[model samples]
Target: MNTEKFLELLVEELELENPLTLASNLKELEEWDSMTAMLLIGVVSNEFGKTLSAEDIKELTTVQSLVDKIGAQQFS
Candidate 1:
């Protein structure tokens, strides 16, 4: 995914208060709920055609980690 597209999706999914970065900690977000988690899963699966497991969700901590999990291959 292009970085801009990814960031656009992130903004939509996360409803972030401030600008996001790879270093942004998800735990700090006020809207980080199970619904948000599901949205993220949907975004990855829909955009990249990869399903993320529960364990995969638990392992994610930051924006960079999500980009890493999706992998460079998923991006153009």
Candidate 2:
């Protein structure tokens, strides 16, 4: 998927009022939590065919970090 579609899906899945950008801080998001992290892990696995450990999730400080984990090449 492209970055735009990824961000759009993330906004919907995370149930955020505000749209997410690559620069969006994960810590600053009110919807971000353990459940959210788990959700993200699942999304990456299912959508991008990648696995993210809890440690990896903890290190994700921004949307771009997660995107990087999923792989920059995974996006258009």
Model 2, residue 41: displacement in angstroms?
0.8
What is the TM-score of candidate 2?
0.93
What's the residue-level lDDT of 4 in candidate 1?
A: 65
Pairs of colliding residues, candidate 1: 1-75
lDDT for every model? 0.82, 0.88
Model 2: residues with Cα > 4 Å off, grouped in runs? none
Reference-based lDDT, residue 53, model 1: 91
Question: In candidate 2, where is summed lDDT lowest over 10 consecutive residues?
Answer: 40-49
Model 1 stretches astray by more than 4 angstroms: none
TM-score for each predicted model, relative to the true structure: 0.85, 0.93
Clash total of candidate 2: 0
- Per-residue CA lDDT of candidate 1, range 1-76, in tens? 6776787788876676667777888767788888888888998898888899988999999988888998966666
lDDT of 2 by residue, 1-76 (tens): 8999999998888788999999999888988888988888888888978999989988888889888888899999
Residue pairs clashing, model 2: none
RMSD of 2: 0.9
